[model samples]
Target: MGWALAGRARSTDEQVLELLEPYAGNRHRICRLIRLAGARAARFGPRLAPQEHRFH
Candidate 1:
């Protein structure tokens, strides 16, 4: 089966940041999660959209 790793995440900013750090180039597992988080936050909360747009 294909790996749908979108839902796998810890419950902390630092932890999420740490995971995404290695994918700073926007091409890795952690990076994808970061993108998903941003979209979700923006869809549910406008304030966080600006922060998420910075990466993409």
Candidate 2:
């Protein structure tokens, strides 16, 4: 899932949302992953700017 998310983060226009879409019903998991990804991105830097829709 990590590799897929990393690839999708760089490969797709949607960034992380495409990977998280299947878990839309699980808000906690979605937020957890987003935080985790943000932390990782903070350490390594983001490949792209995340979309604003995520915080909505």
Candidate 3:
């Protein structure tokens, strides 16, 4: 699931919604997962500088 989300990191929300439309019953839950994954990625994806690690 992580790898799949990572691969679609650049995809727009609309695109994701379209892709997930088939799973109508779980679409909301899936969207929530995507949001959580995005938040996690933003929190730990990369550092702007080598020294930035000390802040975390």
What TM-score should be assigned to candidate 3?
0.40
Best by lDDT: 3
lDDT of model number 3: 0.62
CA lDDT of every candidate: 0.47, 0.57, 0.62
Give TM-scores for every candidate, taking all chains together and pairing residue i with residue i: 0.30, 0.32, 0.40
Query: Model 3 over residues 2-35: C-alpha lDDT tens digits?
Result: 3354554467767766677777899778768867
TM-score of model 2 (CA atoms)? 0.32
Per residue, candidate 1 scores C-alpha lDDT tens digits across 1-56 of: 01222354334655555555656776465555646665442124346434454555
Reference-based TM-score, model 1: 0.30
Best model number under TM-score: 3
Q: Please list the residue runs of candidate 1 whose C-alpha ends up more than 4 Å from where it truly belongs after superposition.
A: 1-9, 27-56
Candidate 3 C-alpha error for residue 41, in Å: 4.9
Better of 1 and 3 by lDDT: 3
The model with the greater TM-score, 1 or 2, is: 2
Which residue pairs show collisions in model 3?
A: none
